[model samples]
Target chain A: DVKVTQSSRYLVKRTGEKVFLECVQDMDHENMFWYRQDPGLGLRLIYFSYDVKMKEKGDIPEGYSVSREKKERFSLILESASTNQTSMYLCATTAGPYNEQFFGPGTRLTVL
Target chain B: AQSVTQPDIHITVSEGASLELRCNYSYGATPYLFWYVQSPGQGLQLLLKYFSGDTLVQGIKGFEAEFKRSQSSFNLRKPSVHWSDAAEYFCASGYFGNEKLTFGTGTRLTIIP
Candidate 1:
């Protein structure tokens, strides 16, 4: 079975603070993704990485960035957090562009 | 651009009852269809996917979906509803490779004992 693990399950931060959400996968997948889930909006992609050091923006990437220094780890960074940035963040890894993804539990972020 | 639609916002069914969730898609050609379930704070789990071959596909957790090319629909069905079946279900569609999936608003399901 594939396992995707997130660094934090829940987090709270103040406005203008820096926030980092980490994800790691044991499956050696080449593709990793970050998405923010919201009510009525469903899951909207924030960023995705196809390989180490290669990143692509998705539906929404404002105020957020990602890092993929290692193949097994992907990190989501909020340069400066804001209240509007509060959301449930999810990370997933796949074998390739067109493959089933294994997702981490998720991190519920709260910005105040 | 490809898009997906899950018409029903919420569906309720008693335990042991049959279940069905409607999903519709809009794409130029045959799209890759997927169904996922989310439980509370957990991430989405792949229940099934439709790429090629047979129109009907079976998934984990006792779920099955049939793809209708004529209607551009992939509706999920279950023979019996379990209490653990209560969760948010999403329908998604995309092309082969490098294409991002567009998800529906999702349908919240409730199981009555």
Candidate 2:
């Protein structure tokens, strides 16, 4: 079974604070993704990494950045958090573009 | 632009009753389809996927979905509903060999006693 784990399940931060959400996968997948989920909006992609140091912006990449220094870990960074940035963050990894993606448990961020 | 639509936002069913959730997609090419379930406060879990060969696909937790090419629909079903099955279900679609997926608004399933 594939396992994807996140650094935190819930977090609270003040406005203008820098926040980091980490994800690690044990399956050695080559593709990693970050998404923010909201009611009515569903899951919107923020960024994705196809390989180490290679990143691509998804539909909603504003206010967010990503780091993939290693194959097993992917990090999402909010350079300066705002109240509007509060959301349920999800991380996923897949072996390839066409393969099934396994997701982490998610991090619910609250930017006050 | 390619998109996924899940018409019903919420559905209620009694325990032991049969279940079905509707999904439709608009894409130019033959699409890769998927059904995912998200438990409260958890990440999305893959229920099933439809690539090409089989229109009828079975998934975890006694769930199944069928793909209809003419209607551009991929509907999920279950023979019996359990209280544990209550969750938000999402329908997603992507082009072949593309990692990006467009998801529907999701259907929140409520199981009645």
TM-score each candidate: 0.97, 0.97
lDDT of 1 at B102: 82
| CAPRI docking class of candidate 2 | medium
TM-score (C-alpha, index-matched) for candidate 1: 0.97
The segments of candidate 1 whose C-alpha lies over 4 angstroms from its true place after superposition are: none
User: For candidate 2, what's the TM-score of chain A, rounded to 2 decimals?
Assistant: 0.97
TM-score of chain B of each: 0.97, 0.98
lDDT of 1 by residue, B33-111 (tens): 8999999778999999998999999999999999999999999999998999999999988887754678898999999
- Evaluated at residue A31, the lDDT of candidate 2 is 93
DockQ of 1: 0.62
Task: Give the CA lDDT, 0 to 100, for residue B88 in model 1.
Answer: 98
Cα lDDT tens digits for candidate 2, B9-103: 89999999999999999997889899999999999999999888988999999999999999999999999999999999999998867877888
**What would the per-residue lDDT of candidate 1 be over residues A77-111, giving only the tens digit for each residue?**
99999999999999988755565667799999999
Proportion of the native interface contacts kept in model 2? 0.52
